[model samples]
Target: MFLSKLALAVMVWTLAACSETSGWNNVIDSHEPKQGESTPSKDNSDTTLASEPVSVGGAFLVCAADDSFEMEAFGCRLEDVTGEKLNSTDIKDGDLVVSNGTQAYSAVAIEGSESFWHWYIAAPLADVSLYTVQYVGQIADILNVETEVQIQHPEKQVSEVTMESPYDDRHLMFVTSIAYQAGQVQNGFNSLASADALCNQHALANGLPTSFKVILSTSTVAAAERIRILYPVYNLEGNLISNPNQFWTNRHLAAVVADKMPSSSEEEEDVTLFEVWTGTSNSGLVKGTETCADWTDNTANEKGNFGMASDARKWVDDGGSRTCESRLRLYCLSQ
Candidate 1:
């Protein structure tokens, strides 16, 4: 449904206040309140709720339920212990593990330049589930953290429930707000990890989900293999970009952008028409060995593959390659 800009802003604000940690961009919960469970007040008048998110050394967990329409799940936001925002540079999907006492759920990065900035993951919510978020110490010391048994309500249809951000739990995608040169990526290292950091930076800064990976491919790894999860992907506008198992094969509903804020110019905001660094062909495989020397070579002699931000036939690759010295943007997808 279309909402007015003011109403949309208000709804988004309320969702942020209720479903996320205050002053932080990480989204920990989207479930409605249960009996005996407390909800934070918008005015900060509720004395029962904790003033800030309870965190340990590496991160903290906010106990909450899932808002996905299809399943009952639980999720928590991972925040830095220092009370600072966690970015891609700070945390990655590999840095932590979230479990429902049985199987492990892959951590999803929910980063945006306009909203939250932290690592978040969700697991299937059991009737009475005990969840744990353990710091894998890929970036810090290992810490085993667990939560008390959380009682979740039975799953129901969207029509029977009210939610904070109904679609917030779904997989998402976005474009980078800033652009980089081929050789300038990661200070000439041209590592995909560095590009991932840039994506997280933009997502965290823009209040979007932070778990983003660059869509570029190298000689060894295909861009299609970089995406961990294959769920339906949506743009910041909540429009369908790709259905499950068809990301590489389908065209998107609209172009993803860095700025998600309601704007008069939002309709005009398209990043795809510009040059984006993607060494992968339309088939999601490496187009050639011309990956700017694995995105490290920035000299004029070296070249890298690129695509128009608005490619229709080739998806991302436009069958074009440019010198590594050329400045371009990167396509980041949230897994």
Candidate 2:
């Protein structure tokens, strides 16, 4: 099903107004003037619901439920998982690395334990999940930030739905942001935490089993001046969902880019903030210091449903970022 760009924009804008706090770039490019959540940045409190989302048929959503993993299986972490609102990670170290087949594991467990639960391990493959990626310049992004780009990836395994945008004849997206600073790294940084929840919510809002994926940073006291990564093409998805076995801890087959960053002048646009696809949920920023990566991953498509008719190609041709959060469009698709 083809999505409506104008419609999507309107809906997103409306949702953002209600959220009162996220950076709705797909809809509204500016971050909230008030800082309602944690900062990696700053804030604004005056934004309100600009309008209401036009509901088709009726004003409510009737969703079809799925049989999936239950957090009770993971015990205390379950609540920690559910209660979380966002996932923000710091990329203390690298930029362009590819994923091996194995899950690109989080070295630091949330709340400080050794390893995450097996369920938590299901991140790259969980339903109703959140994932954020540090975005740089891949194809066409006018904004200027270094080392981090938060994102949302949604999927419905069995449902057929259509989202639309508002640009009448303009099928192309024009990303134009001022330059910013990404100070040369001294250590590694983790990816965004709240960015994870925002993405998962995107899928769920659309009535699909939710799963999230994004790129994050890990700091090493002496990792490198410029952080980079490469996940095996096979291990990586258009989103950052990578196969653990094939790409885990490995960098051979991964697709990557280096030295593709903002210069010191451009780095002045450096604002450690979020430019997101806003929705009707609470402000997109969950906790400044809290990240969802601490949650367990489930084996099943635990959030929504899906179908096979949607067009991802159009999403790109329509002006989506060349690499908003780590999608690789330059490589040849596996035949």
Candidate 3:
């Protein structure tokens, strides 16, 4: 059922461009001089692809250590595990990266055709251990690589405040902008099923070293970034800036802009740009979500939430989702 649901989500996403202009989205000019095209660049030579950068902090240990307390506190890791942990860290980019913790570590940051493996699990960043042995592999093939993000940072609208600390004294207000980037991990380019399966296989191969408890928590401070995004003009899913339990995804946020945003080229029009901030607490966990539609005409089961998921309810001033008003307060406009 979950696989079917994910498959449906992929289809819906494929159809997210279910509009007239969709045809014009990725038109390419074949005739245009390949500005930097090498005349014989297509030697079709057998060129060996370089391996990714993998960092192994320590040698393989039999135990896995998880900082469940911190993950729950950040609202990212819902499960908590307490144990004498053994995870690797102190590593550098790329390489068939394996983790040092009780469970194998997964740090994915790309998208394309994924197997069931890649879709169901996420890499927790809190105290992740780098493997001692090196890994060699290919990167996930994806689209929009970066620009496909639902919440984009401002193009060039940021402010500077050098005045004395507003909160350093007895009277102060905490402020920041809540932004999210759409993370797509594709298995083979345009291959969702493949990607999903690959991830599953990988996860199974790298089983969790141990079963530890996962904890959850909340804080008034966590709401800081979310508050800035909630504003008077913005209305997500017909709710005020404050809505909860409504599932929302990066794609949902993109839908909000797709429907509410002015034409991309509309002169002088204001559009909300976003950036994904994963595991904000320096935990290193990558934060993201996905969605799909059932498409059945039954009251018992709606076709889908119509892109209305709990995570979808952003523009919230609480610690739950992103908002704009908080941007005004922090005066740190994203770009």
Write down the worst ten-residue block by lDDT for model 3.
Answer: 74-83
Tens-place lDDT digits, model 2, residues 1-335: 24688788889999879776554443565444343443232265434533222212211000111234242111011111112211223111232221223434332123333322111222333321232222221212211111111111012221333323222211111111222111111211123333333323433443423333322221211011111112112212223222211111111223221112232344433322212221101101122211112211112221111101012212112222111221111111110
- Per-model CA lDDT versus the true structure: 0.57, 0.22, 0.23
Clashes of 1: 25
Question: Using lDDT as the measure, which candidate wins?
Answer: 1
**TM-scores, in order shown?**
0.45, 0.16, 0.17
Q: Order the numbered candidates by lDDT, best leading.
A: 1, 3, 2
State, as a TM-score between 0 and 1, how close model 1 is to the true structure.
Answer: 0.45
Q: lDDT by residue for model 3 over 64-138, one digit each (tens)?
A: 122232331111110001111212222223333343435554433223322111111144433322322223323
Superior by TM-score: candidate 1 or candidate 2 = 1
- Given candidate 3, what's the lDDT at residue 254? 18
Over 4 Å off in model 2, which ranges?
1-191, 205-208, 218-243, 249-335
